[model samples]
Target: MDLSCFKAYDLRGRVPDQLNPVLAEKIGRAYVEITGAKKVIVGYDIRLSSPDIAEALSSGLMAAGADVFDIGLCGTEQVYFATSHYKMDGGIMVTASHNPKDHNGMKMVGPESRPISSDNGLNEIRDRVLEPFGDAPQQGRYEPLEVMSAYVDHLLGYIDAGSLSPLTIVCNAGNGGAGLVIDELEQHLPFEFVKVHHQPDGHFPNGVPNPILPENRAATADAVIAEGAAMGIAWDGDYDRCFFFDENGRFIEGYYIVGLLADQFLRKTGGGKVIHDPRLTWNTMDLVKAAGGEAIESKTGHAFIKQRMRDEDAVYGGEMSAHHYFRDFAYCDSGMIPWLLVAERLCQSGQTLSSLIDARIEAYPASGEINRTIDDPPKVIAAIEAKYSVGAKSVSHVDGVSIEFDDWRFNLRMSNTEPVVRLNVESRADIPLMEEKTEELLAEMQRLNEER
Candidate 1:
């Protein structure tokens, strides 16, 4: 019931303090009241605290006159899939998602896996959770279902693996729930993949499973080189965002992967629309356009991108944050799809990960995304816009501040869930220039913030 758990995008905080059984019960009641949903699906990750939280949450949902369908031991994406697949009125995922073990949270989706963040009802949920109601509501029944096998089969339905050739790859599940899926899927897969941290260890003794952190990426890169594998892939705690390592043990940027996945999906869909975040490379734009598809840009967040995808009827969407969504998957983001497509691409083209990326590296040089902590985000953004906004070029205030030039572009924006400013810069095949411009803009951002 604590207000601190009401985040910008989702409800998240420490287990006992900000999130607990009492709080979950209130949110469940509030969710049903808000959505008028009669049936709700729920799932959790491999964290030790997840099961308890799920049970508490289920109690709350049932108390609110909602039937709770518990999909035992699954990832966040699985909840999204179940919400759409089972025609449930809504779904909730009890996962902190790459956070440390002490943390726990809930991600809710409306019917069709539509997100419910602060703008959509998180604030109202928080208010209702804190408000003292006289008595607990009537309880409904509970049912258990096994949706993992069916979800996997549904994913594999989109692409054929029979045409794939043999290749050695390394996979690191980072001791999250993804280990369970990898263990099952790898058994029938045709590729030679060396699995690491394939067991579900809630402690995550090695490290948090986030692939964005440079420290976390090292293990996957090292495993790829040590095993002499063609490529490496790692998943976050809930397996929603996938990160990749090349054959030479080099970590690839998520921006590039966006373009790669956009290309792959467009290939099969035959020129359908593709959606991408504004922060990343124009390479995705070019790739989508070149494939005879329309490219749409949206703010950098799963909720926003998914909504945009559904509105545009886009076939696929990818964000620099590593979340990829498919129209077939109810426009919800998945950490599982990127790696599967990467594996298929490797097999079909008979090329290494580096080679596949290398072919496009020349056309899409990038400085990688950078983050800066600041107090006055608006002033900093306004200063950058005043200085950088040119007459002929385009400038947009979609999510944050985005400016497009003839040969280069950059997006400087504040994080939706954090207090930091994020800057993503990319240029036309010029790494040095990209780095220089990135530094220049970052310096200006800092200077303006300091002045204010």
Candidate 2:
């Protein structure tokens, strides 16, 4: 059996060939056997193959003597919510989350909604799938769980609705499951929503809902401008990550959003730790300190940020890739909570989104994440580091090689899944200097790659 669908963080691959009902059922049984989970929460996205695959997974779980609590047609966070909120033993979300339409996958979490990735039980579950399975002494039952009301209530608890005044907001779901959630939250808020691509369609009429791609951002930006709204928001297929657009119909880099969210969340917490990814730092660090909060950097990725949050008991955590995690929400990332907080901030501050973000951009000019394909990433990185670290104030490798000078700093790291090396450079209130260093770094990297 082809188990190539199994990945380092989660499972994702072409459907039917690498993943299907047969493999899903085996994976489900293996999950139960490995975890000894008695009660499990199951949810799926709006993909065409999701329901059938979820059904088969549940059958195998029941066969292994684990009762299933099915939360149908929801985002990945809903599974995390139901599992931890209701005290389920574990949860599984059948979603390919912004992958190509023809692909499918699953993300699993153990007790307390802690991720079950390759470092823990995911690999064991994959290995167990190939072994034989026997029926349990007693079969387990299945029940459809209603979680939207409780989940939505939890989301609302994160912000001060009393402070929120009337404003026009644009939300583009890109024909993904985010629309279902927006519709549910709409009745309780004062904002007038300008819905674009609002319907939940497996066909993805507007294409896959990945807003990080430049091409996918136009719908939300155009809608915000066309409706004359305060701001715009977009989400990926499972609605676990959300991107932002300012009132002027300009896409805001996720790096800036991280700083904004950290400041906002710190105000509510009165002073707490904020975990952030290491790829970009100066802006977030400045804002976090001014807000009377400590900013801690963690290795990029959901699992690493979440584990660090749990360890530090941080109030909030954010990544430049649009993933935001909340301490109140089982240390799990949410697409809904971040936007709600931003909306509240707008109402209280009474300033346009651009004004709020522009000041930060001026204070800290940044080269948003840039990727380059390198023949030998390690060799090129080493050469760059030897040449660049001579007069640098400090150099560290939390996730990648980050070198800091008095006026500027840059990080160069290789992608875990691809042959591309990612770079991010920033300066203290000097856009021209930031741009110059960015160009110089790229040129040096290209020359080094040629040598390699």
**What's the TM-score of each model vs. the native?**
0.96, 0.99
User: Which 10 consecutive positions of candidate 2 have the poorest summed lDDT?
Assistant: 410-419
lDDT of 2 by residue, 69-157 (tens): 99999999999999999999999999999999989999999999999999999999999999999999999899999999999999999
Clashing pairs in 1: 240-335
Candidate 1 lDDT over 1-452, as tens digits, reads: 35687788887888889888778877888887778788899998888888888898898788778899999888899999999999999999999998888888999999888999889887887777766654345667899978888898987877777877777888889998887887777766877778888887889988888988998888888888899998988999999888889999898888889888888888888899898988875889888888888999888888888888888999999987888999999998887877888888877777778887886777878777788998888888887888899662899988798898888889888988779999988888888888889889988887887883
lDDT of each: 0.85, 0.94
Best by TM-score: 2
Cα misplacement distance, residue 54 of candidate 2 (Å):
0.7
Residue 104 accuracy (lDDT) in model 2: 92
Q: What is the lDDT of candidate 1?
A: 0.85
